[model samples]
Target: MQKTGLLFGSFNPIHIGHLALANYVLEYAPFDEVWFVVSPQNPLKNSEDLAPAQHRLAMTNLAINAEPRFKSSDIEFSMPVPSYTLNTLQRLNELHPTHDFSLIIGSDNLINIDRWHNFRTLLQEHSLLVYPRPEYPIEKAVIALPKSVNVLNAPMLDISSTLIRKGLKEKKNLRFLLPAGVYDYILQHRLYQQKKE
Candidate 1:
């Protein structure tokens, strides 16, 4: 079975941090491919400042265009708002029965995994590839993590889409923070620009 890592995110603009982490996971982990699962909306997060799903999906597609092992997924676009990971996993299994899917998430999310919808069953049925976040310490949560979850020593990228959007709104040049073509796409679409009052 081919192991696929599902990195779920809003991917408002899909930056270098996302690509770098995915690449690092592929190199150091056992995953055959990493899929960028672009979310339409996160139940746990506010939708304010979120780019349109089409734009987010397009940006994600642009960022991973050159990488064969990387894929962009819009599985949540047509699903109900506030999409749940469990549902997405079930859908993927039905669509691609041969591929083995695992959740790729930051340690911060792992610590709060219980808050997710049907989390216990999600953890029991699928594996997780957790990477470190600067603020979240996995050691404290080790006792709570399931046996199927594995932590990777991949580089901790502190970059975030929130800061990227802020920088763009502030007229800061953040091209280096994003993957090739993504910055251009954001610019061309005038995304994340401050709306004049």
Candidate 2:
């Protein structure tokens, strides 16, 4: 059976760090394909500064188009607002019963997983692959997580979408932070450009 790994997140902008992690997972993990499930809205985050769902999805696609193992999914976009991981996983399991589905998350998010909706059910149902986040320790999380969890010691990326957005607002060079096409798209669309007085 084919194994599918879901890398769900509010990829406000698909940065190089995100791509790097996905690539590393694909190479090292048993997963056959890694889907980037672009969340329309994260339950715990403020959406005010978030780029539109379509725009984020488009950027993700552009960034991963060259890779056969990387796929961009808009699964959360079709779902209701404030998409929860449990619901998404349940639905995906039903939709693709033949393939096995596992959840991919960062250590930082795992720290707050207990607060998510039906988080207990989420842990029981799917295998989790948790990668390290900058300034966050995975060992602590590994101790707390159930036997279904796999801790990946992939290269930690200090870059984040928030920092990239801030760089754009400040008119800083974001050449290597994101894909060239994605960077160009942001420039062409004037995304994150602060209004002048």
Candidate 3:
């Protein structure tokens, strides 16, 4: 009867903000371990802009190394294209019956849940823990959600992968936003420093 909250994301560089959110869920939410499911491809995101899955996974591992309660998972790497949430959840359910999976998402994402494939089924089958995004209203967002979904007040850091990438492209310093070694890893590999020509 172990409960594990899945924090699914591309984790392009595994920033401090991402680690903070996952750590917050482990402390505040009813979960034993918080797994960062490194999605290979997201339906709403452009894969061309994504770093290689291995690099992203490596950064995630580096970022969560100090936290015993946090883990990095490459579960979605082997999954189908367009990487739908319903598919990933169903696969995880079959593979690990011992661990019950809940979803940790942001309020802004909840606003677009209707666009996700079989999103209602996802809600009925598992728990959803949502944290706030800067401009998204939790009160208004929760109104359309079901009772199983719980809203969390995790600090909404204005950090985003897109912003980080933009900073890199412009040759701006953004080393403080990432985890201890993640910034080093990104520098070593020269990821997202400029858009691929």
By lDDT, the best candidate is 1
Model 3 error, position 184 (Å): 1.1
- In TM-score terms, candidate 3 sits at 0.94
Who is ahead in TM-score, 1 or 2? 1
Lowest-lDDT window of 10 residues in candidate 2?
Answer: 135-144
Q: Give stretches of model 1 more than 4 Å off.
A: none
The lDDT per prediction is 0.91, 0.86, 0.87
Alpha-carbon error at 45 in model 1, in Å? 0.9
Candidate 1, residues 89-112, lDDT tens digits: the string is 999999999998988999889888
User: Poorest 10 consecutive residues of model 3 by lDDT?
Assistant: 137-146
* lDDT-sorted candidate list, best first: 1, 3, 2
Clashes of 3: 0
RMSD of 1: 1.2
Error (Å) of candidate 1 at residue 80 is 0.9
lDDT (Cα) of model 2: 0.86
The Cα error of candidate 3 at residue 55, in Å, is 0.7
Q: What CA RMSD would you report for each candidate?
A: 1.2, 1.6, 1.5
Superposed Cα deviation of residue 5, candidate 3 (Å):
0.9
Off by over 4 Å in 3: 140-143
Q: In candidate 2, how many Å is residue 114 off? A: 0.9
